[model samples]
Target: MVSGGINEILRAVEFILSKLLSELQSEDENDVEPKTKVRLIVPNGSCGGIICKGCATIRSFIEKSQAGIKISPQDNNYYGLNDRLVTLTGTLDDNKCFNT
Candidate 1:
């Protein structure tokens, strides 16, 4: 009789755990954001790109903002002028924040 009671309790605990696990998984799936918005930061007439890759502020923003940033490949022409393509995983507001 005691063994039967222990087995019932164990099964109940397992059922409760499975329900909690599914709920937690659903919440995690909703928490992640997809990168859909794209913006191109054009270069200036002079040296450095609009978002200078070498700048400390830009690097810090990229690391924390969860946005994807790509600069034009360096070459003869792009070296003097660069274009920064920013892919925002969060929202359009992120670009304004980064620009400031």
Candidate 2:
């Protein structure tokens, strides 16, 4: 049961990230300012129980949280589709994530 719950959380995180990236990529280039915020929230309760669970379960969640899109600042890559979306979506350091 614990493993399944963790999997769901991992998937949720990925879905949120993907949406953020997509939103960042659809902005107008001529605009002077981007107006969007990207936030990810992982509840403390999700990570609270079952310390004795298998290593695979723990590792999977950790890996998913660390997963992120990599953007290149050169070649105007920062203005690329995904990059723009990310910019409009704010950042991971915004109010999306919290450590409990």
Candidate 2 stretches greater than 4 Å from native:
1-4, 29-100
7-100 in candidate 1: lDDT tens per residue?
6866664455456445655666664432244444544432253355567655756677655555544455545544444443443322334243
Q: Which ranges of candidate 1 are over 4 A from the true structure?
A: 1-32, 45-53, 74-100
- Model 2 poorest 10 in a row by lDDT: 80-89
Mark the 10 consecutive residues where model 1 has the least summed lDDT: 91-100
Q: Judged by lDDT against the true structure, how good is candidate 1?
A: 0.48
Q: Name the candidate that leads on lDDT.
A: 1
Give the clashing pairs for model 1.
Answer: none
* Best-performing candidate as measured by TM-score: 1
Residue 85 local lDDT, model 2: 21
What is the TM-score of candidate 2?
A: 0.29
For every candidate in turn, the CA RMSD to the true structure comes to 21.4, 16.0
